[model samples]
Target: MTTAGTPTFDDRAVVLDGTLVVADLHVGRGTGGSLELPVGSNTELVERFTSLVDRHDPERVVVAGDLLHSFQTVPRPVDDTVAGFERACREAGARLVVVPGNHDTMLDAVWDGPTEAAARIGDTVVCHGHEEPPEQGDRYVIGHDHPTIEIEGQRRPCYLVGADQYRGSEVLMVPSFNALNAGVVVNEMRAGDFQSPLVTDTDELEPIVWDEQGRETLSFPPLGEFRRML
Candidate 1:
C-alpha cells in the first residue's frame, strides 16, 4: 500500500496500492506542428514519469498500448527517446511490459496478439482501450480515448474515473502520458461507442472536459456535480 504523503507524478500510470501500471509511453518531444500540443512536452513527460517510478518504488510497470506514436517509420528522436525510457525503467528496478496500439501496429510483429494486449494485475485488467474491452473482466483500465477536461475553455488531458453501471465493474480511463497528442473530449463522445453498455449515469466516472477557447462550455464536473445539477 502507498504510504500517506507519498509523492505522485503527473504521468498516466495507474497506481493501485503500491503497484503501478503505465500505458502509452510515447517518449518524444514537440508536436506534429509548431503549436505546443495539449499533451505537453514528451521528453519532460517521460522524465517526470521516470522520476515518479523511482519515487513510488512500484512492483511493476505496464505499457497498455501505443508505446510509440507510429511504427511505420520511427523518427530518430523518438527512437532515442524510447531507449532512454527503457534505460530509466531498468534503473528504477521495475519490470516493464509493453502492449501494442493501432499507431504502433508494428509492435504486433514483436509482441503476440490482442490476447496478450492486456496485462492482468490482481483484479484489474490494463489495456490500451482501442478495441472492445475484454468481456470477462470485472475491473479494467484503458487510455485510447486520451480523455481530456475542458476548464475555462482550456482543454487539458485528464483521467476519467467511474464505475460500470451495468456490470458493476470499475473502470479507469487513463490520460495520455504523451505530451504531443491532443486527447478526445469525453462529453463530445458516446460511452457506448467504444466499450460496453455497462457505462451509464454514475458518479464514479467523471468527464473532465476542456475549454481551449476559455468558453468553459464543455466542462463537466465529477459525476456528483452533474447529478446535483439535474
Candidate 2:
C-alpha cells in the first residue's frame, strides 16, 4: 500500500508504493515484429530492466500493459522473450505483475505470474487505459497512449499528467517502456488518436520528460497552453 504522496517519475518507470511500474515493453519488437526496423534484442530488454531494478530496488515490478507484441502471430521467439522477461524480473528480486492490453490478448499463452485487468495501488488505479478505469480509485495511472513530447526540436518519450474532467480523478499517463517505440507526441495528437478515450478530452494534460540518465526532469505546460504558444 502506498503512503500519502505523489508517484515519482523516472526513465521508463513510475515509482509507486515500492512498485516499479512500467508500460508498453513490446518485447520481441525487433525482427519486423513491432517496428519498421529492428532496434533492441531480448537481452537488451533484460539488461535494461535489470538496470532499472538494480537502481530502484523496488519490492515489486508492475507492467502496466503490453508486455509483449505480435498478437495476431505469436512467434516462438517472442514467446521465449516473454518467458525470459519473467525470469529476469524474478532474478532482479521483484515480483512481476501484468495488466492486459489490446496487444496482450495472447499474453496468457506465454507467461503467467500475477495478471489483472486493473489493480488498486492505494488511491491510484493502475490499468492499461484501453478502457475506462474503475471509479473506486481517486487517481488513475495508465499506459496505452504511449505518450511522448518534443523538446528542443527532438522528441522523447514522456509522462502525461493532469486532472481528468470526465473521470473526475487525477490521471497519469506513462510512456512506453520500449525504447524503440517513440510514442504519440501529445502536441500532435488529435481526438481519437489514443486508445484510451480519456486522452481525447484531457487537453490540459501536462508533459513531463525525463532525461536519458534519469538524473534530470523537465515539465511542460498542458497541451492547451502549449498549443496557444504555437
Candidate 3:
C-alpha cells in the first residue's frame, strides 16, 4: 500500500491517498472490427479497470481524460462502454470522476457525473494535460502525450516524471490506458514535440516503465542523460 503522500502505479493508473487515477481511455476507438466484436475495446478497458479497482480498493476513481474518442458524435456502443465503466466503479464502491480531454468533446453526452478542468487530490492536480489547467497544486498528474519508450527491440508504455517541470510543480505524465493506442516514442523528443503545455523541459523528465510480469517498476535516468545512453 502507498503512503498518504506517495503515488503508486499500476496498469497505466496511479493511486494516491485512496484514489485511483487513469487517463486516455478513448472508449470509441478501433470500431472497424466487424460490428459483431464492437465491444472488444470496451471489454479490455472495463476488465482492466475493474482489476485496478479491485487491487487498490480506492475510495475514488478518476479518469484524467479522453474518456471518449469521437469528437463530433457518440456511438451506441461507445455509450454502452461508458456505462460499463460506471457499473464497475459502482460495484467497487468508488466514486468516479472525469477530467475531460481534447478528444472528449462529446464527454457530456455520455458522462453526466462530476468533472473538473483540473481535479485536485491532496497537493497534486490531475488533468488531461492537453491544455493549461486553471487550478494550481504542488504536483501535477497528467495524461495526454501517451508516452512510450523503446527498450532492446521492444516498445513499451512509460510514465514521464519531471521534477519542477511545470510552473515549478512536479509533473507525472501517465501512458494511455487503452492498449490499442500505440503510444509516441519519447526517446529523442524535445519539449516542443509534446502537445501538453505543462511539459516545459523534456530533458528533466525521467522515463519509468512498469513490468507487470516481473511485478516491478524500472526507472531510467532523465531523458537528457538517458538519450546519450540509448
lDDT of 1 by residue, 46-127 (tens): 6766876886777676777777665465555665456666677779877667766566755544333233567776566667
The segments of candidate 2 whose C-alpha lies over 4 angstroms from its true place after superposition are 1-4, 31-40
Q: Write the per-residue lDDT of candidate 3 for residues 1-230, one digit (tens) a residue.
A: 21138789888888989889999988877746432225467777888988998888999989999998778877788777789889989998999999999998988899999998887787788999998888888889999999999988789999999988888989999999989889999999999999999999999999999899987788999999999997
lDDT of 1: 0.60
Q: Which candidate is the best by TM-score?
A: 3
Candidate 1, residue 205: how far the Cα is off, in Å: 2.0
Q: What is the lDDT of residue 65 in candidate 1?
A: 75
Q: Give the candidates in order of lDDT, highest first.
A: 3, 2, 1
**1-230 per-residue lDDT for model 2 (tens digits):** 54226778778778887888889988756644453225446667777777787788887788888987767666666766677667767777788888878888778678767897787778777888888765457777889888888766888888888875335777788999888786777786755677786565647788888887758778888888887776
TM-score of 2: 0.88
Is candidate 1 or 2 superior in lDDT? 2
lDDT against true structure, model 3: 0.88
lDDT of each: 0.60, 0.76, 0.88
How many backbone clashes does every candidate have?
A: 14, 0, 0
Candidate 2 collision pairs: none
